[model samples]
Target: MVLKKLVRYIINKYLKDYIEQLDYEKLKLDLKNGHVCLENLHLKPEALTDLSLPVTVATGCLEKFTLIIPWKNLYSMPTKVQIDGFYMLIVPKNGK
Candidate 1:
């Protein structure tokens, strides 16, 4: 009925707004050297597959390590979301 439709519409709107707010807050967090939890988001597939050889070599040369942890490994339960890149690079600060 009309009431059911209205309720559905309101729920959808609230979900959308909540997702946007989460994204904004996440952007403000210091991702550097900190792990990011992407439990309910989907990322581009290309970014997941594409690897730059030069970058890898440079990192190796500089003795820096890059770790890619699958989302499932970080989370206890399987989520409905698939991230573009399952893992995020956490670069340490110069002095740290």
Candidate 2:
């Protein structure tokens, strides 16, 4: 239980910059197998800031986000990431 909270805290802290209104209730973490998943994530316009594009995201959402880590073989195997049902609405910046 404590580990779950810690994981949640860490994820929320790092993801806050990109995700808007991230639903913690929907987060699932399995430390035993090193799996993390989040569903129905809404994204903020600033989420794309690092991309440095001339457009902005008017709205965005992801149905599912998953991360898998091979804890047993941490050094041998590669971590995996999967995103599903990603939807985004983009618009050009006024000045750009």
Quote each prediction's TM-score: 0.19, 0.85
lDDT of 1: 0.31
**What's the CA error at residue 58 for candidate 2, in Å?**
0.8
Find the candidate with the highest lDDT and give its number: 2
C-alpha positional error of residue 54 in candidate 1 after TM-score superposition, expressed in Å: 27
Question: Model 1, 1-96: lDDT tens per residue?
Answer: 553344335434644422322232222111242322323332222222235322211111111112233444557643232234333343332351
Candidate 2's displacement at residue 20, Å, is 0.6
RMSD of each: 16.8, 1.8
State in Å the error of residue 80, model 2.
1.4
Task: Work out candidate 1's RMSD over C-alphas.
Answer: 16.8
- Using TM-score as the measure, the top candidate is 2
**Tens digits of lDDT, candidate 2, 1-96:** 997888788778888998998787888888898999999998999788899999888999999988888989999999888899999999988891
